[model samples]
Target: MAADCEAWLNANPVEAEDLSDSFISAEEDNGGSGGTNKNIHNEINGNWLSSSSNNLHEARLKAKAKRRLRKNSSRDSGRGDSLSDNGEVARGTPIAPTSPKSKLLDRKSRMGKGRGLPKKGGAGGKGVWGRSGEVYELVEVDKKDPNFDEDQENCVYETVVPPLDERDFEKTVTPIVQEYFEHGDTNEVAELLADLNLGPMRSEVPSLAVSLALEAKASQRELTSRLLVDLCGSVLSHSDMESSFDKLLRDLPDLVLDTPGAPQLVGQFIARAVSDQILSKSYIEGYKGKVDCEHARAALDRAAVLLKMSLGGLRIDTHWGTGGGQRPVIQLIKEMNLLLKEYILSGDGKEAERCLRDLEVPHFHHEFVYEAIVMVLESRGEKTFKMVLQLLKSLSLSSIITVDQMRRGYERVYMDIDEINIDVPLAYFILEQFVDKSFRMGIIGVKLRDQCPHRNRKRLVSEGDGGVVKFERY
Candidate 1:
């Protein structure tokens, strides 16, 4: 197009000298006539010449294209024949790709192409950014960037992709869960456990699930925690009400009571554990709840009997069953009494009285209020001999005396220290000035060596109303 425009301008030069000097100028009409005649003739001739030049240029282009195509066909035919003669392609000689896009495929497979391509910049004629491995053509962004609203030079344009959910970014989601329990997707797993249908797997669910949840919580396995909590609930539910009265003795456990639960739930759970013989033996014997009505007393006695029978199978000290385990049972009893105290405080003296009767504490020396503990080993329904004890084994004489409002109970030989509730300066005064003073005297024993024919003589002594003993001093 440029050449055609230039030719037209050169041929039409105004000055004769300029026309002669022009590269594309027409010949002058040196043999022609006047300026008017010459001007008309020149106009006619110029029009024809321009049309002729255009036609000739188009024809020349078509001929050149045909020649080049013919040469290419010849070269291809020759190469095909040579290849047909041999079994394999020549080394280092690249075979022509059958497809129009083969040129690109060949280049892509070359080693280190990625490294070299980026430096060369864009693929094809795109210039700067064309060579992205699997290239995407850049469409000019017609929208103005909102970030430009701020005049600061901090605007950064990142490659835009669709927003992704966790599934789309799992490589990243793994860590996201770990950051914190509340926010992380890891809870989804636990939630899934919560959703599990327990219809067929009810029993197994708790055992399996609780173990897993505990493990996860302990080991910090966030993914596993969901199932764990769900399982814990199931285990707790199953532990209750599955055992029977006979098995109750061995089934009760202090742990069942100690585990966190609604008060009622904990009590029920303990009852069930006891029924199943799952409680520690010592625990059964000593089991106590806040309430000590006939129901709890019966349960406690049943547990204690079973514990005694099942001692062989129990350790009750450290791991399984041992002597230390007996403490939990003691605790249960104490707890029951404490509950009774609450009843007493609440003006439910009738219930409190019932509790004292069930525990076999003297009717007046109610268990919680009375300082003495009367331990009776009854046999054959006969109340011949009695042994009195204190609830908390060791107590300072001072506190015991002040706290000993109820009269201390008595055994056949040992007076119930609880009898102090009777009167006078009370237990404190008795312990400080009377019981502790003379009670220290060792038991009286007659010398068998010189006691003619082993006759028990002069071995008897007695105490006065003040617990002071007088001896014959022989």
Candidate 2:
């Protein structure tokens, strides 16, 4: 039997204890031995039952542990599946419950915010992170690759400008000045000059303009000269341009004197301008009315002097008339002076008649000499007063300037007595002498107003403190 047991044990070596327990339990149930065997069977049966119960309890515990493991595994796998929805994961990873807990916690944390923390990504949602806690980095989309150097090899940048030459200068500056002269648009002139970088040379603009005009065609020369005159007129119209025009006009004398043949050219220029009616006597008078009198006088005087100087030495090729054989610029220069003098003695007829001999245009003699007698009365100069009286005597003898013309002339020069600048008594004396002479000459209908028209006249009688006497006509 022991040999058989040994063979059985060897046959089932791994389950030897289990087989022995079962065999012992079966033997206990049979009850085939004596009292000693029976007692042993009873104890063995009790031990077998306890061992079986313990084995069943252990099996249940193992099954319960396996179920718990499966449930937990499914829960972790579901969380891993959700995370897989977010993105794929690497293989063999024992997914932890941390995924669902972390996600739920992350959601709850986001909801509890007051002022929220700044998001992980900035503008354009760049560099965002995934739900799986993975990072997504930003990269250049439209920008050229900074790493490439192929374009740099073929490109270059130049900083230096080529120098401007004379041809280009003429091409650029000539049209600008010409347009200015034509339209008389000062702002356009300024803007064009500024574009050419010539704004800094503004003081030389007029001279440069003149040079350009001389270089222009003869057909356009008259227009250019007229433009210069208009430019001067516009410039002199403003108070700020007074000094500029003065400076320009002052510079003209030197320009004429220093340059050979310039005066003759200028003379021809003036003759053409005058004939074209570009330089009108009325326009010049209007310009003089606009500018300072001193400047106007100086400019005219300088031009006259320049012409006279030209006549002194230079023999210009140009002549004034076709067959009249007149000198070109000399007559115009004299005419300029005569016009200035006529302007100076505008209202006084007696002075106008006396100065009429100096004027070439006899048509204006009536306009100029209409107030000669009044001019003599208003004269502050003793010589001018006597000369005017002598002219009136000669006119009275010739019966040219009649008593009616004298009356009209007197009425014109007569302002208020207080406004008169000459000595009142002396003026009255001169007037009395003229009246006595008119009476002796058998001039009838000579009218005269006695006593000052404006009663605000004062006289010095005795050359003392009480000499000043105020007279009022009643």
Candidate 3:
């Protein structure tokens, strides 16, 4: 039995307890018999230990192999089936792959909810968590429908403005006409009028424009005439313009109360409008003999007279004549120069002053001052200078040219004195003398003397005895 146990132990060599010392001690105490029994016990113990360890290792390896197979099987299930290196399926049954969406649906179904989180506190069913509520079904919209919109629903709305009556028209149009008078842009006025719902009172525009111009200045009348021509076919129809003039003719008696020359001005407006085709030729013919009011008759007669003049249509543009600041700068300069030349040749101070007054440009009198000073500087004779000086004094004394204007004029000359010196070598000296005389005459202020530019006089050089150079100051 001991030999069989030892043979089993040799076949499966494994770690076991050391029994050699116990067996040796037993043999010494009980001879051959006790030694055999001790060997048998040791062999039994070694056999038991080896068999238990071998069984445990085999069980553990089997469990490990089973776990590996389960892991591979799970991985292959997700990818349909395991694929071999040769691109062949290595599976029992090929499973279909699951999409993420299907997987999500499966997960949701498993949780007993189709989509979204369970309602707060377990209240489940549609909107803001579940009591009975209105359910909205989303329906596809037809894009071919006329009222359909993708981004927003189509909406219809209407804005209506009350039509202007005669009184309302006057109130609304008064400021527009005034602004037109200032800017003098007919297109702007037309654009403004286009925005208004004039309705049946459209005829009132022409009459109101002319009436306002009559009460205002000559320039306003000219602008009003131009506006009538521009707005003829556009804003104001031919019929509207005719009706407007009829109203103006009827209102002449009232208009003459404020503007004594209203009849004449209206006549000019009518003639110009007719010539420009804004008013029909038959317009004046219609009122030829039926006119009752004397002012109206006078206006009609004046219109007739202007229409009969040669080149009347073209000439009527200058009927008002440019006045004050309205006249072109070049024209004003020419007229002023003529007045100065005439004054120099004739020595008539009153006539020169009268001509300047008639120019109607008190605002631009500084230009005259600059021109007169330039004339004096350019001229040779003392008499001509004295004459220009006398005219300036006369203007100053009469208050036609303000002291401020005179000072500005001298300052302008001072600013350009260097340029003037190119033409007139004695410009600085002449300017100084003129300023002194004018200051003493009270034509220029006392402060003007300090403002005048001083030019350094050139030094005279001469050779003295012993070849020495001497400098003489002017």
Candidate 4:
């Protein structure tokens, strides 16, 4: 019967309409037992429908179960079973979730493996673990090592400068002092001194500077005095200054050989230094009786006289007197006039040259030139004119007055010739003669000759007389 049922199910597919028709036909054919048959047919139909639905549900459930089994198998394979201590597999062990730090370490370990780096327990790169069973310790840098200097390891070095000696100091400082004389900049001199390692020879600075001043012009002496004052207590200590002045006193005889007035100048320097506090009061007193050299004694006496003056040591500052450009313009003019007047009286070219040198106004030589030419023009006697001309010639030949200065002087006279003519009617004639003479003597250039002014001569006719008087310009 089961075979028949299976064969019937396989041959005829179940349809709702066909099933309903079969139920209705069975009900009709069994009408005498209709109620019982109808009940039975309903039961059979219900069972068949329920059985089909159940079979579909069972099939879906089986497929889901199979998927679950396959997933479990894959998951279990990926995380193989852990072994017990007895070597038996342990089932159903929970895996704890991996932390981020552990995961990163795991990834690093994998990367290290690819690079052929040893594991944590094995020795490999620097500072890594040793491969031996016993862990090897890392070697530390020993502090006692002969070449070890932690500070020096990171330090940078600079080049060391060698010290300068005495002869070298003199050679270097002489030009420096000469330059100071030219510019008279004490601060600049101080900066230059600071650069040098004067060492123990620092006391030599004042002596050398004063010595140079003694031989130099008054302007240089004044500058040197100021230099000593500025450098005192700063570059040169009080002791250095005293020793230097002592040395200068001892060397005064030698200094006087070249400069006859060295004693007086040294006296002035000593007084000035003492007044400026570069040297103490005892500096002069120390040599009062002990100074055996006549020059040194004279210097000390001069210093004593200066200190005893009403103005006290203050007078020493002006001891050298202001010469060069330091003097007032009017004072300079007066001095120059005095110099010219003295030259006129004495008629000594050497004395005139000496006075000009004492003036120390090389830059103002043009003024001297102008004064000389004007003096010649104002003078009446030929001898005076010749004397002035001779002086100009001497100055020109000696280069005491440059050609540029001579030309400028002549040009100045020409510019003011008309005014000069108002004062002295014969001024034009005298200037013409002077220019011609100077040009002939090669004291001035030809440019001045061409520039010489010519006076205009006019002809006058007497009224009603018809007589012509020719007015001639000298």
Model 1 stretches with alpha carbons more than 4 Å out: 1-71, 74-78, 81-279, 288-290, 308-474
Instruction: Please estimate how well model 3 matches the true structure, expressed as its whole-model Cα lDDT.
Output: 0.77
Better of 3 and 4 by TM-score: 4
| Tens digits of per-residue lDDT for model 4, 239-280 | 898888888888887888899998998888888887888888
Local distance difference test values of all predictions, in order: 0.35, 0.46, 0.77, 0.76
| Candidate 2: segments with Cα more than 4 A from true spot | 1-384, 399-404, 415-418, 421-444, 448-459, 463-474
What is candidate 2's lDDT per residue for 214-254, written digit by digit as tens? Answer: 44444344445555445544332222223333344445555
Candidate 3 lDDT, 22-93, residue by residue in tens:
233445556645525544433434564455454454344444555655655664554445644345676654
Extract clashing residue pairs from model 4: none
The global Cα lDDT (0 to 1) of model 2 is: 0.46
Positional deviation of residue 385's Cα in model 3 after best superposition, in angstroms: 8.1
Could you tell me every candidate's TM-score relative to the true structure? 0.17, 0.22, 0.54, 0.62
Sort all candidates by lDDT, best to worst. Answer: 3, 4, 2, 1
